[model samples]
Target: MVKPVNVGIVGCGAISAAYTTTIARLAGLRLTAVADLDAARARATAEANGTRALSVAELLADPDVDIVLNLTIPAAHADVALAAIAAGKDVYGEKPLATTKAEALQVLQAADTAGARLGCAPDTVLGTGVQTARWYVDNGLIGRPVAATAIMNHPGHERWHPNPDFYYTPGGGPLFDMGPYYITALITLLGPVSKVIGAASRTRSERTIVTGPRAGTTVPVTTDSHVTGILIHDSGALSTLVMSFDSAATRAPNIELHGEQATLHLPDPNHFDGEIHAHPVGGTWTSLPTRAGYQDAARGYGLADLTTTPPTQLPRTSAALALHVLDIMESLLTSTTTGQATALTTTCDRPPPVPLGPLEPRTE
Candidate 1:
């Protein structure tokens, strides 16, 4: 029997609820504790989930905590991850890995020094949607892969999120916030990126909250609200990306990849399952059958993937992959400033594919 991995969650925020629900359903995981700077928020989450509430420091030192699920803001990701690694705990966090590559390297190095495993999010790609698409590519259904396009656009998060200040800060722009899902999916479908050229702009200097207690309150926009880039994969495939908070909307598919033989319309990388349409060179568009990945998977599946994976092997959502994704995003921004193509300094092999199966505890 595979023993359940005990989880201690740091940062009791919006994403924590989804993870909480997922942990309760997974047979190979247990939600053991919860922590936050706001003691009340942590206590409420713990009470609702039948777990103990502890201070952030206390939770990190908890002997019972096998992994620290970091739901902290991007700025605090490295600090929280490093602290957990120091305490001999594995860590998995929300995307971007850290605010900058320098800080991300520190977390990776710390995890290595302590012999602790590390992973990060955008695990939605491990679900049936992208996996089925990956299955097609791997099986040569698309023939020789050539190019891809990833697009995401929204007016702004201030229209919905209660606390929208962070979304406008350095680490919270459209590219950093939503690019992980698309970029990770693209990498999974194509391969590691070798070079990137980018252009970006911020249409608004400030934005106003349209929802919650801060309704009508304005916040500064410190990062690009619109970013476009072209990623040249090592396999010679190119992926065009458009991420924006400035657009009112877009009717474009979340992601689409073209090859010598066919064109694939992929579902949203932020979602687990959806229709995957394909149009061959000489055939009309049709929905492909799902042939891979965890069925009915959700947010915390990556943590479960980490737990069931052999210690000698890397998980599908390994920290190395997340760091590489972060490097790509950071490099794209740097390219926007330099007006020259940026070569990637970090690279990772595409994560091992997930074979089609029910979402469950694994034993091997």
Candidate 2:
């Protein structure tokens, strides 16, 4: 029998509930404890999830924790991850890895030196929605891929989140906050990017909070609210990307891939599953059956997947990939400032595709 891997989460913020819920459902993982800078928040999360609450230091030093799930805000991701690695625990965390490429590199280096495995989120690509789309691309159902477009647009999060100040900070802009999903999905389908040309803008200096106790209050915007980029892939595929917090809505599909033979319409990479449509050169649009990825997966499935990875293999959501993704995003932001195309200083192999199945096989 496979013994479940023990998990201790650091950071009991809005995203902690999803990780705790996911751990409860997966057979290969167990939530043993949780921690946060806020003592009360950690205690509350532990009570709700039937686990122990500890200070951030105690949780990292806990012997039972095989992997520390870093769910802290973007600015603090690297610090928490480095601390976990120093404590001799492996780590899996939410997306972007860190606020900057330099910080992400430090986390990767620390993990490498400690001989600890590292992984990061935006694992939605491992789900049926994006994976099914990858299936078509890989099987040549879409022929030689020529180009792709990915877009994520919404009015700012200030209207909904009680604390939306982070969204406007250096690490909270549209590209950093949401670009991981799109860029990671694009890399999964078209391969690593070689270069990028970017442009960005901010709609306002401050945004008023419309909901929550902070309603009617305003937060400063220190980062771009709208960002557009053109990624030149090593495979010779050109992918245009738009990530914006300024737009209220858009009619564009979340993603689309054009090939020699057909065009594929993909569901949102932020979701685990959705419909995929295809249009042949002279044919009408048609739906494709789900053909790959973990069935009914969620946020923590990547951590579960990491738990089962062999010693010689990198997890699908490996930190190397996250670092490369971070480098691309940071470079894009740099391009916006220099008004020049920037070549990526880093790249990673595409992750192994997930076979269509449950995270853990069911027994009859």
Q: All models: lDDT?
A: 0.94, 0.93
Top candidate on lDDT is 1
Worst 10 residues of 2 by lDDT: 355-364
Give TM-scores for every candidate, taking all chains together and pairing residue i with residue i. Answer: 0.99, 0.98
- How accurate locally is residue 318 in candidate 1, as Cα lDDT from 0 to 100? 91
The regions of model 2 sitting more than 4 angstroms off are 361-364
State the lDDT at 7 in candidate 2. Answer: 97
Tens digits of per-residue lDDT, candidate 1, 292-321, equal 999989999999999888889999999999
> Which tens-of-lDDT digit does each residue in 111-212 have in candidate 2?
989999999998899899999999999999889999999999999899799999999999988999999999999999999999999999998999999999
Each model's Cα RMSD: 0.9, 1.6
User: How many backbone clashes are present in model 1?
Assistant: 0
